[model samples]
Target chain A: MTLLKNIWEWDKRNFERLRRFQLPHRFKQIGFALFLVAFLALLAFRFVNNDATVIKTSLKYILLIGLLIISVSKEKIEDERIVQLRQQSYQVAFVVGVLYSILILPLVNYMADVIFKKESLGFEVNSWEVLFIMLLMQWFIFRMMRKKCS
Target chain B: MKNTLKVERAILNLTQDELAKEIGVSRQTINSIETNRYVPSTVLALKLSELFKKPVNDFFTLEEND
Candidate 1:
């Protein structure tokens, strides 16, 4: 019983450690460079080939991964102010994202009817688009607010 | 809230980086507090108090707007 208890405590500590873990500054910098290059390369390929299928499949994955790296990476000095800004970013991103999701359906319908001239409207929105937009908003707002605050 | 953190640090002859190290926070945090751009938490306030050998109220006080 004591051994089991010790194991549980150790596992709990490890879980907490993992929960608070962040990548080193150098690794994050390298990740930023690599992802930027990959994104530009993919974009150029899409522009040249004009392949809708390939672009639809691979572009989003690179975007999602790059956004994840941006969000997860730590600053040179991750202090209380930065943490507060992060909280603000999350709150703003969530509210904006939900509002966008609500408004986008009607906008999409309008676009389909007027722009696309489609008779049959089966409006299905992609979830990744919303996620990407939310991530972009978070990044933009966080940077802007941080700049104003600091 | 308003604080005399810059004055206190000056009295102690401590740089922002040194004070931040003693307080287990980043230098930018100390700078922010000094510039009145950010407020420290209760625990951080107490830590500053302990480091400066002064009461929390001596370092921080409420302004009319606060």
Candidate 2:
């Protein structure tokens, strides 16, 4: 029991330490700039050479990394309340993102199949797309909650 | 939980922004606490108590639902 208690304490201490792991506030702007540039590059690549799957995949990963930087960066005022909101936003976004993948995407695919009067195209949602959705949703919900609280 | 933070701040003639600055928090945090939309952590509650020069219980009290 003492050994188990020690392990629990160590885990808790590490978790608390993780709470302080955030980039400085300026990284938020830099992250957004990176995301924007990668997004435009991806669009231009799609227009120019849609067959370059490797390059497209690489750009998508860069976009995901940019979003991750933004998500993990501190706000201008890194208060406890903002931290709480960020946690809440992440939780909500994960649930919503899963529901979107399981329910909304399939529903849309079915609707498209019916409307187009074509056979099912077996549309698959990419993992990167889901991550993008979750991050965007988290940001939107966090901003809305902040605005309402303010 | 409910708190008399707004009333206490008013008595001291301190705006939300000023109180937040004193506590090293955002103005929105003060607003959230005043509006009863957020319950501060023990550290924050202690900070407020220290700032107001009162016991934590003087400003913060438990509701029956809490």
Candidate 3:
């Protein structure tokens, strides 16, 4: 129980003025953990079935969104170290995502033209990877703006 | 912004929590204002002055540069 409480406290974080977000955070975390376990299970049984691949892809997105929601609840963080870590981690994610997207465009082209010699196939830019990039970018921008304004 | 909040609260013998509950804000907000970490909005400033039975200017000041 003490260990579990420690994890929950870390995840929910401290609110500067109020602890209003704690209840919703606990529920979000439960859902997030469930999604993560299912996602990992799907990964473990990858060779079991073809349908599992499709299910995994979709579940990946749902898991990403759930984690994003839990991570971005605006709980009014007060600890300076946590704030700095969050700011830097988000910046790194955003930079990597943008670089990956830029590289993917050219890399995918090269793969279709020179490497695989297959017909060009466009993918859904709204896929989980793209959504992850966007969420990271959002976090970076939010933290930067918060730092500048308040 | 300049404020005489600590002075007024001291006169009224109101603890930060009591003042916060009376003003519908959290104790942290009161603490922030008292420590000059944050400035309250106009409505909140007025409410606090009214609660202390003082003129708004008694609690707030407008610097010439502000």
Q: Quote each prediction's TM-score.
A: 0.80, 0.86, 0.48
Pairs with steric clashes in candidate 3 = none
Which candidate tops DockQ?
2
Comparing candidate 1 with candidate 2, which one achieves the higher lDDT? Answer: 2
Better of 2 and 3 by TM-score: 2
Among the numbered candidates, top TM-score falls to 2
Candidate 1 residue-wise lDDT, B1-66, digit = tens: 889999999999999999999988888788888899899989899999999999999989999988
Report the C-alpha lDDT of model 3 over A72-140, residue by residue, as the tens digit: 554343333334445665777677677667777557766777767777655424456666666656556
Model 1: per-residue Cα lDDT over A64-108, one tens digit each: 777767877887878777888888998999888887777876577
Clashing pairs in model 1, backbone N/Cα/C closer than 3 A: none
lDDT of 2 by residue, A1-150 (tens): 999999999999999989678899999998898899989999898679558888788888889888888898899999999988999999999999999888888888899999998788555876777899998888889888888776
TM-score of chain B of each: 0.96, 0.96, 0.88
In order, candidate lDDTs are 0.82, 0.89, 0.66
Residue pairs with backbone atoms closer than 3 Å in model 2 (clashes) = none
Which parts of model 1 are misplaced by more than 4 Å? A1-4, A50-56, A119-123, B13-18, B21-24, B63-66
Give DockQ per model, in order. 0.58, 0.80, 0.04
Quick one: RMSD of model 1? 3.0
- Positional deviation of residue A32's Cα in model 3 after best superposition, in angstroms: 5.3
lDDT of candidate 2 vs native? 0.89
Worst 10 residues of 3 chain A by lDDT: A74-83
**Could you tell me the interface RMSD of model 2?**
1.0
